[model samples]
Target: MAGTLGIGIITYNRKDTLRGVVDSILRHTSTDFEFVVADDGSTDGTPDLLRQLNVPCITGRNKGISWNRNRILWYLKEEKRCDWIIILEDDCFPTVFGWERPWIDAIERYGHVNFMPELTIEIDNDISSGRGTPEDPFIAPMHQAFCIGYHAKALSYVGYLDTRFEKYGEEHVEHTQRFLRAGYGGLSQHLSPERGQLFYLRGGLDTLPSHSHGSHELAMRNKTIHDAIRHEPLYRHPWRNDEEMFEFREEIARVLPGPAPEPEGEPQLFDSIISLGGDELVNQAIRNHFGRPGPGLFDQFIAPFHTLVSLFRHDFSGLLSTNCLYGYHDALRCRDTLLIYHNCLEKQPGEHASVEMFHAQLPLLRHRFHTMIQEIDSLCHRSRRVLFVRSWRDGFLYAGQHRPAHVASVDFQALVDALAARYPSLDFRVMFVNFGKAHATDSRMMFANTDTPDTCPRDEELAGWSRLFSTYRIGLHT
Candidate 1:
C-alpha cells in the first residue's frame, strides 16, 4: 500500500541553511505530506525565522539529540497520525526532481530506506549478514536516521528504539544500527556518490558538536547496543496500546519561594502586559506607577459608553453604573513608574481628550516619541518600552483649533528631565502603538492644523502624545 507520508526536519541553529532546505522541499517535492520542523532551543534567530515562514515548528528546551528525535517521533506518531515518517536533518536535500515518489516506493518495498544508501553486508544468518563500519549512522533503530522513511506500524513488531542514549557521541548512529539489527530491514539500495537524484547538503555535516567526545560517545553507545541485544534494556517490554500516556508533577513545598527579587538600583521599563486572568490589583499597581493604564478592553466598557452617551445628551454629563464609575476611578489612579506626562499638568486632561495644539504639532510629537522610545530603551537597560497613544475623539483634534480653554500646567520638560536623572542607564521604546485618530493624524494625515504655534505648551500635552506623532512607526498595527 502507498502509505501516508509525514516529513520532518530536525534542525538546530542553521537558520539560513534550514530555510534553503525547507524551501527546496516545499518547492521541489512531488507529493503532499505532513511536515514539521523540530527545533531544539536554537538561540539564534531561527525561531523567529520559522515563524516568518509560517511552518509548523515545535520547540523544546535543549536536552540533547535523543530528546529532539523522541519528541518529533512521538508527536508525529501520536498527534500527526502519519503512517510513514521521513525524518531528515536540516542540511539534507532531494537530488531528483521528484524525490518523494521513490522515497514512498523505497518504504513500501524495503520497510525503511535513505536517499544516499552506503550499505554493508548484514548477517542475520537467514537473509542478512554482518552490517559493518556504520560506526554511528544514528544508533537509533534505523541505522540511517539522516534521511530515512519508516513504516509507523513497524514499531509494533520491533519496540521503540532505545532513547536513553543521550548524546554520548555516536548515540543516534548506534540506535539506528540497533533498530536495524532487530530485523526490521527490507529492500536496500546503495546510493552512489554520482547518482543524480537525492543528496546531502555540504556533504552532510551538521553545524554543531565538536566531536571532541567521540570515543567516550562510542563507548557509551556500544554499551547500550550490547544491553539491548541482551534484552536487559529497561524498555525491552513496551506498552503496545494506542492510548496516550499522561504525566503530572506536584510542587511539594508549603510556602513556595517568591520570584527572585529584581536587583536594586534600576528603574526598569518592562511593559506590563495584562491578560484575561488579571484583576484590579494589577490595574491599581499600573496606575500607581504609569499614570495611565495601557490600552485595554476593560475601559471599553465605560469610556466608549460615556462618549457615545454624551453625544445623545445636550450636557456632556452621563452616569456610569456605580460599578463602572468606581472601576474607571480606580483605573485612572497615577502609577509610580516615571509617567511621561503626569499631574505636572496644572490642569488634568480627561483621558483620550485631544489637545488641538498637540495634534496640530503632530509632526514634532511623532519625532519626539520616536526619539524618547530609543532613549527609554537605553536607559531602562535595554528593556522594551511600549508607548500607547490613542484618541477616542477622532475629529476633535482635526476640528481645526477650537482648542481647549488655555489651562496652566506644570512644566512637562522638568518632569522628563527628572525621570532621566533618576534612570540614567536604560534602554527604551521598542514598540509604539498609535490608536484611532491619533494614528491617522500622525501617520497619514495631510490636513492643515489651525491650532497654531500649537497653543498648548509642551508640558500640557497628554502622556504618550509624541509616540502618536513619532516618525518611527513601531508595532503600530493596533
Candidate 2:
C-alpha cells in the first residue's frame, strides 16, 4: 500500500547536500511514503540525479525557491496521494536511529497534528556557547526541517508558500505561524533508534544546537506585509505577497558569501546640492558623475526621461538621481532627506521688487524659507541632512534700481557667502548659474527677459555660473 504521508523537499543547485538528505530518508523510514522534491531549476547535475532516484520528483521552473515551492504545491494537492505532507530542506538530513523510529513513531502517534523533527546545527561544536548552550536549546519551532505534515485541507486553506519571501529568511515561520493561528497544534519528537539521518553541513545551535538564533526575521516582514495588504490595493495577503522579502533574503546570502567589506568607510568628500528653480542642468549633472551609456546609443538617447522616471518610481531599482523633490508635495514627502524649491521670483518693477523696495516681502519670504529651514533643522536632530537650491539673475544689481534689494536676496553668491559665514561649522555649498542676463529665468527663457540690456557683454560670468551649476547638479544627483 502507498504511504500515508507525502514527503516534500525543496532544492536548488547543491547536489551534494541533496544527495545526503535523500540518502538519509531512504535508510531510515520503514513506511513507503511518496517523497516529493520540487527542484527549482538546478543547472547542476541534480535533475539527472533526481530522475535516477526511485522517488516522485517534480522539476519546477526556477522563478526562485519560493515561487518553485508554491508553483508545485498545486500539483501535489491535485495528486491526492497522501493524508499528510512532510516538508524538508536539502541542507538538512535525518539520522539513522533519530530518523527511522523516533520521527516515524512520533508521526504515527501524532498524525493529526503537525510534526517537526529535532533540528540541530551540527557544523562546529568546539565552542561551548555555540549550539547546545542554554540559549541554543534543542526544542524549538519548525524550521526548514525533515518532517512537517500538512493536512490537505490545511494546504488548501493556507494556499502555498509565499513567493514573496523568495529566498530563505522567514517563509517557514510564516507557514508555521499561520498553522498555529489557524488552531493547529504542532509536535516535535527526538527521533530514537537512529535508523535515518537528517544532517546539515552548517547552521544549527551548539550540542544540541537546534533553534535558529535571533527572532525570526519573518515576523517583521509579516507585519509589513500585513500593513501593506491592509492599505495597498495590489497586495493580496498582508503576510505573504512579499516582493521585499526576497530582496531581504538575497541580501543576507550576498553578505555571507564573503567577509563583509566594511562600508566604504565614510568617503572623504561629499556634496550638499541646493537646487534652484527649473533648469536642465540638474539632469546633465547626474549623467556626468554616474558614467555614460553603452553600445545601444540610439535607445539611450530617445527614451523619454519620464519613461525612465516611471520605471524607477516603483521599487524596481535604486534612485537614479540624488533623491529628488520638486514641488510642495515632494518637499513635504522628502522632508527627511533634501528639500528643494523654485523660490526664484520673476522680474517686477519697484513695487514688485524684493524686500529692498518692498521690505514687506522680506518677512513673508523669510517666514516661508525659515519654516523650511526649521523643518530641516528638526530632521537634522534626527540625523538627516538638508540642502536648498536657489538661483537668480547674475547682473541685475539693485543698488540704484527701485527693484527690491531683497529680490537679490536669492542671489547665489550672496547666499553662499552669508551661509558660509553663518554656518561655518555645518557643511554647505551654493551654486551660481550666471545666465547671459541677470534674471532667474532658465537658459531657454533668457530671450524673454525684456529688461535684459540690448547689448549684453559676452557675459564671461556665464562660464563661472555654468561650471558652478554643473557642479551643483552633479553633487545633488550623487
Candidate 3:
C-alpha cells in the first residue's frame, strides 16, 4: 500500500553509460515504479539508443545540470504526481536485486535519502557509532546528488534545484542545505554490505569513459554564485519570477512533446504588456481592466529608485538584472500587440531628484538610451504594433509634494519621436498621459490614494484608468 514511485535517470551525452545503467536497473531492480530517462540535449545517438531500448524519455536542450534535474522533478512531482521520486545519474547503476527497497523505505522514514555506491571502513565505523540499523539508516551530514530519493512532500517543501548554478558544482550542496533548513531528515549513509547494498558508481574524471561535463572554471563560477546567495533566503523556483516562469514553461513546452493546451480565455487587448516602475498597482489596474489573470513580464518588476540610468546601461545580452531579464524574455514571446507603460513616479517617499546627477550621467544615459531602444526594437520585431504609454510627472507626484524634477526634465517627446522614426514598420505610437493640474480630482485621471503611493486602484478608479488608456487610440481591436 505504498504510494506511487517515480525513477528518473538524468543522462547527457553518455549513451553507453546510460544504456548500461538502464540495463542494470532493469536486470536488478524489482520495484514497480514509473521509470524514464531525462536526456539533457545528448547529441550522441542517445535518442536512438533510448528508442532501441524502448524507454520513455523526457528530452530538452542542454540548460545545465540543475535545469535537467528540475525537468525530472517537474515531470514526476508536478506532472505525474508521484508520491516519491528517485533521481539517478547515467553513470550510476544498480548492484543487487531489489536495491530500490532500502531506498523506498529510507525515503518513507527520513523524507529524503541518498544511497552510497561503496562503503569504506571509515564510513562503516561512522555508521555503527551513529545508530545505523537496517530499520533506520544513518543520517549523514551531506548527501550525494548522483543517487538521491525524496518523498513528494519533502520535495514540494524544498522545491526544485537552483537553476542559477550552470553546468554543475555547488547546486547540490545548496539544495541539501535548503532541504536541511526545511527541517527534513536526510539519510545518506547506509548499512554495511553485510547488512544491505545500494548503487554502483562509474565514469568520473579518473575512470575510463569519463563523462564529466564539469570543469574547474565552471565549478569556480558556480561556487562564486553559490557563496554569494547561500546565506540569502531560499529561492525555490527554477525561474526568478512570474515572467521568467512563463518563459521557462514556454521553453519546456516547445522542446518537450505533448505540452498542455492553452487555457481558454477572451483575447487580451495586447499580445503582451510590459509595465515599467509603478509596482503591482499599475499591473493590477491593467489586469482588472482587460480581465487578465496576472501581470505579464515587467509588470510587477521594480528597479531601484533614482537608478533609472541602470535600466539603460546595458544591451539586452549584457543586461543581468532580474527586471531586465524578465523584460527581455517577455519581449521575445510578444507577437501581435506590445504595450510598454512607463510611470515616472516610482521614486520613494520624500526622495527628490538631483539635476546635477542627471547632468553628470547625461552622456552615458544618451548612449544607453540608444542601446535600449535598439534592443527593444529587435526584441519586438515580431509584433505587428507597439505602443508606449509614457506617464509624466504630473498631478500624482505634485499632489504628494514629491517632485521628480530630473524625470520631468527628460524630453520624452524626442525619445518617442526617435523610436517612431526608427521603427516605422512597427507601427509605433507613443501616448503621453499627463494630468497638468495638480489638484485634478478626477479619480480616472489620477490614482485614488496618492498618500499610500503603492495602493492599487479601486474598481471605479481602474475603470477610469482604462477609459484614459482607451482614449490614446493605440488600435486595441479587441
Candidate 4:
C-alpha cells in the first residue's frame, strides 16, 4: 500500500488569489493528499474562504511565513497524515494535471524536487539555476525554497524551518541549507520544467526585503556558494506560551541530524548598519531590546579598574579626527566609532511593532554590543577612557525600578549620577546638545524631560581629552 501524501499552503492578506488557488489545486493535482492551508492573520475574507473550501486550517499564528508552514507540517507529521509533503504559497497553483503525482514520485527517486514547469522565460542566466531536463534536474549551488516537496522524514532528519527570520525571506533558504547539510544534498532539485506547469503571480512582493530582495543588515547570504552557515539566530515563535515553545524546540532538536561543526575563527563583533527609530521611543528600544546601561554586580565588583567605554552612534565623521571636532556639529563633538547604524531602530512604528522588530534585530545588536564591551574590558585594564552615547528619548528610572511609575523623576544630572555610581570611574561629565525647540511644547518632547545642559562640549572638554583619553582605549584609529 502507498503511504499518505499531504499538501500545505501559506497565505496572507490576498483573499481572491487564495480562493482561486484552492480551486485550481482541487481541480488539478490528480492524486490523493491531505491538504492544509495556513492563514497568516489575514484581515481579508481568507478565513471564511478556507471555511467554505473545508480544508483543515492553521489559524491565529500569523507570526510569519516560516512559522505558518512549520505549523502545518508539524501538524501533518504528528497526525501521520503524510509520508511525503509538498509546501506551496497561496499564489502558487498547479496548471497541469498529475501535478501532485510527479512531485510525490520525484521525492521518492530524487529525494526532493522544487515543482516547476518549462521556463517560457529564462532562469539560469543569473541567480536561479542552470538549464536541465526532467530525468536529472540541475543541482544548483544554492538551496531552492520554491515549490519544495520532500519526504516527511526529511523534517525529522534535517531540522524544521528557522522561524526567527521574518516573512520577508531567508528562512526557507536557511532550511534548505540545513537540509543539505544533513547529507540530503543530492536528493533535492528543481522539477523538470517539461513535466510540470506552475503559475506564479508576479506579486511585486518578490522585491521586498521579506521576499526576494536585498540583504537586511545582518542577514547571511551566499548566492554564489552552497555552504551552510549559522549566525546568531533570533528567539521568536508563534505560540504565546513560552513553556510550550521550549518543549516544541526540544522535541525537534531530538530528531535533527547532529549540530554543525564548531566554527574555526572568532565571530565578528561589529555591524555598520543600525536601523534606529526616531527619538520617540529610542530609550525604551535600547533598554528592552539592545539592553540598558547600569552597574551590575560584576560591574560594581570590578569598579576598582575605573575603565571607560563609550557607546556611540550616528556620524562622528570628520569631528573625531579632523577639523570638525570644535563643535562644528553639536552631535559630533564627542567622537565615537561607527558600530551599528542609528536608523535600524526605526523599522517598526508602534508598541507591538516595536516588540516584533526588537526580537528580530536583538541578536545582531547584542553581538555588536558584546564586541564593544570587550573593548571596554581592555580600556579598564589599560588607559581608562570611557565614552558612552545614547540618544535618550524615554525617561530614566532608579537603579532597581524597571517601569516609569516605580521611579519619581530623573534628568541629565540624574543620568550622570547613575552612570558614575555604576562605573566607579575616575571622572565623569554629562554634556547635552540642543537639537530641538528650547522647551517642550506639550507634555511630551523629543528628548526626555531633563535639565538641558547649556554647557556643551567646549575648551577642556574638547582640549584636555588627552589627560583622560588613552591612545590605546579610545578605539579611534585615524
Q: Please provide the root mean square deviation of candidate 2 (C-alpha atoms, Å).
A: 22.6
Report the Cα RMSD per candidate. Answer: 19.8, 22.6, 17.6, 22.1
What is the per-residue lDDT of model 1 for residues 113-178, given as tens digits with 9 covering 90 to 100? 543333211331121222221221121112334576666665444444444545434444444443
Question: How would you encode candidate 4's per-residue C-alpha lDDT over 1-478 as one tens digit per residue?
Answer: 3878888887787777777778777888777888887777678878788878787666653566667777667766765458878777765777766667656665665445563333423554222433333354444444345467767666667656665565555666656655544444343333431122211211111111123332544244332221333532222243445543643432222222222222435421211111121232222322333334221211211110111222221111211122222221112121232221223333434323233443466576556545545554444334343333323221111111011122333343443444455546523223222112222222111221121121223332223222222211222211
lDDT of 4: 0.43
Question: Which lDDT value does model 3 have at 14?
Answer: 92
Which portions of model 1 miss their true places by more than 4 Å? Answer: 115-142, 159-161, 168-170, 186-230, 233-478
What is the Å distance of residue 417 in model 2 from its true position?
96
Q: What C-alpha lDDT, on a 0 to 100 scale, does residue 249 get in candidate 1? A: 5
Clashes of 3: 0
Candidate scoring better on lDDT of 3 and 4: 3
- The digit string of per-residue lDDT tens for model 3 on 236-335 reads 8876665445434533332333212223455324443433333344556556655653223333233322222234333322222212111222121111
Query: How many pairs collide in each candidate, listed in order?
Result: 52, 39, 0, 22
Cα displacement (Å) at residue 46, model 1:
1.6
lDDT tens digits, residue span 366-412, model 2: 45544544543443333223343332321122111111112332333
Please identify which of the two predictions, 2 or 4, would achieve the higher TM-score against the true structure.
4
Candidate 3, lDDT over the whole model: 0.54
